[model samples]
Target: MSRARRLTASTTAYILIPILAAVSPLLVLPAITANHGASAWASVAIGQSIGTALATVVELGWGLNGPQRVARTSEKASLRWLTLSLQTKVIALIPASAVAAVAAAFLAPSDSLTSSLVACAMTASALTATWFFLGKGTPWLILATDGLPRLVCLALSAIFLVMGAPLMTYPVLGLLLPSALAPCLALYIAAKRAPLGTKLWWRARAVISALKLQSTALFARAASAVYIALPITLVSIASPSSVAAFAAGERLMRMGLAAVAVVPNAMQAWVGAPADRQSKWSRAKRAMAANAALGFISATIFGLAAPWAVTWVFSGVVTLDPISVWLFALAIFTICTSRGTGGIGLVALTRVRAIAVSAAAGACVGIPAILLGSAWGGVPGAVAGEILAELTVLSVQVVAIRRRLAAS
Candidate 1:
């Protein structure tokens, strides 16, 4: 199979997985609220947050480092870096699993004990599998390998939801089970197809060394977790209803942005090609313009239709204030614009360090804003914080690109 075909297939699968996974969760929100109440759900969300934060740190570090190494070194060296990242996840899982077990044993269980356990297990498994694929597989294969499990689980959850199963258990179990199983399967395949040749200890040390060298990425991951994940956390703190509201807005934004992501994703490969520098620049510019235009059209349409869309799609599950919905729509537009421009520039230039730095700056600006905003303004404040942070990062990225062009 051709690489382009493989990449296209993988991207499609990756996109579908999230969309499907979201379905069950989105469906069950109303039921969870009815059964467990907001506070219980909030507690569960907190536990999930811990797992998410850990996963984000590991995943983002790998993303930043892997691409940088790929740009700078041979594909073999890039594969080695990917292998090291997988090792890091496996090593981290040992500790994470221990913690999860202790939490399950000692901590007061939520409404869905089985679901929570499954969620934790799935988290670890998914992270491990994702890293493994990153190390050994082609990009498309890696994406598909990571995404397929989630998609399957999501399908199952949807079926269960229609059958009137416990809302909390079905969604969490569906999501988590696939996550756990995919990695185990991936590992088995990996072992059979391409067994590890290097000494385990040596591999571990190499990963650690890479991790140390990529401290900037580590910091970037940490900051990104705060920047992207904080809204979910804050919404939980504000109110379950708030979470539903913010989630509705964010979901719409995400769908639109996903469409816009095609350009940047394409630009990553174009930038790395051995073409004339001016050609690369022109390609990047065109991509940026196309993405920006798409973003504007999508945002405008979404903003105009948000009320009916929210009412029709999420009526029973979430009730979003018009103002809040509008803010979210606007924020989505800004984010897409920022991401489209920044993504093309960064990928084209292979500026991994700059991307990390920009993420860190955004996080620094966002976290405090979110905290203060949630304390003072609730959901509105959280939205404002996100917008401010994104703007700050976008401004920095724009300046950086301009400077690079000047130097060139």
Candidate 2:
């Protein structure tokens, strides 16, 4: 297939995975709010929030570093690498699952065991052929194995919501079903097609070493998760109403970010291709510019429509103020412009520490911002902090990329 076709297909699949997956929350959350009220909706949202954070820990940099490994590896080594990576994630999965169970115990009192299991499943979903597919430049495969199951589960969630199933059932169908299905399907596909030679125990040892190598990339990935997941956790602590309002706005913003993520998803594959340094640098610069343009357009359109969208999506159960909605738009634009181009470029270039440091700096600015903002102005303040945090990360990513280019 042509490079352009692959990029477009991959980007579309990548975009669809999240958007389709989001249908669960978009449909279920509001349904719960309309049926049971904000407290019930908050219960599901809290479970999901905690689950998402644990899921990030389970991924352990595979999503970011796995693509780079795939990009640089020979075809013969690809399956072996995939197996090895899967082993490493599985090892991490054990402890992470334990942690999730404990977290669910404290955080999700309504249905702790089920919620924890859901969280563990979502976290384990990261251990699949996704990175291998992205690395092999067959990102469309991700749509089939990863995206399809979630879409199927989304339909189930919608049906359950319409039937007025119990509140916990919404999360069970929405979060647990998809999280369990997607990764299992991806791993099955990989195992049927390509078996690695590494023994289980040996693979475990090698995974330790691999973890050391990928530590910086892992750090970067974890830091990125903070801004995305932390606010939900924080808002839950603040108030049930705040959780509903913030989650409503945050989910919409995430959908927009997913749309523009096609740029970076393509950039990673494009930049990872074997090429001269100068040419790669040129492509990176162009990709960044293109991403920025897309971000601007996405931000403008989404910002304009957000007020109406928020009302409709939440069924008028919860409505964010204008400032919160616009700040969400700004956050969407910031992520769209920076994440796909600048952020992925750093990973492709193996500037893992640079990316990690930059993301850490943003978190340092963001966590406090979120706490203070939520305390002061609730949803709007939290979003204001989000805007500043993303902008901070973006600024650092640009400077780091520039310095890396000049030095090279």
Q: Highest lDDT, which number? A: 2
Regions of model 2 farther than 4 Å from truth: 1-24, 108-118, 191-202, 239-241
- Candidate 1, residues 58-139, lDDT tens digits: the string is 5546654354235444444444555566666666666665555454333323544643553365446435444333323333
**Ten-residue stretch with the least lDDT total in model 1:** 130-139
Candidate 1 has which clashing residue pairs, if any? Answer: none
lDDT, residue 39, candidate 1 = 46
Total clashes, candidate 2? 1
Model 1 ranges off by over 4 Å = 1-50, 65-79, 93-144, 161-172, 184-202, 237-241, 255-260, 275-281, 309-315, 341-343
Q: Which lDDT values do the candidates have, in the order given?
A: 0.58, 0.71
Q: What's the residue-level lDDT of 45 in candidate 1?
A: 50
| Local accuracy of candidate 2 as per-residue lDDT tens digits, 340-370 | 5445677656677887887798889988888
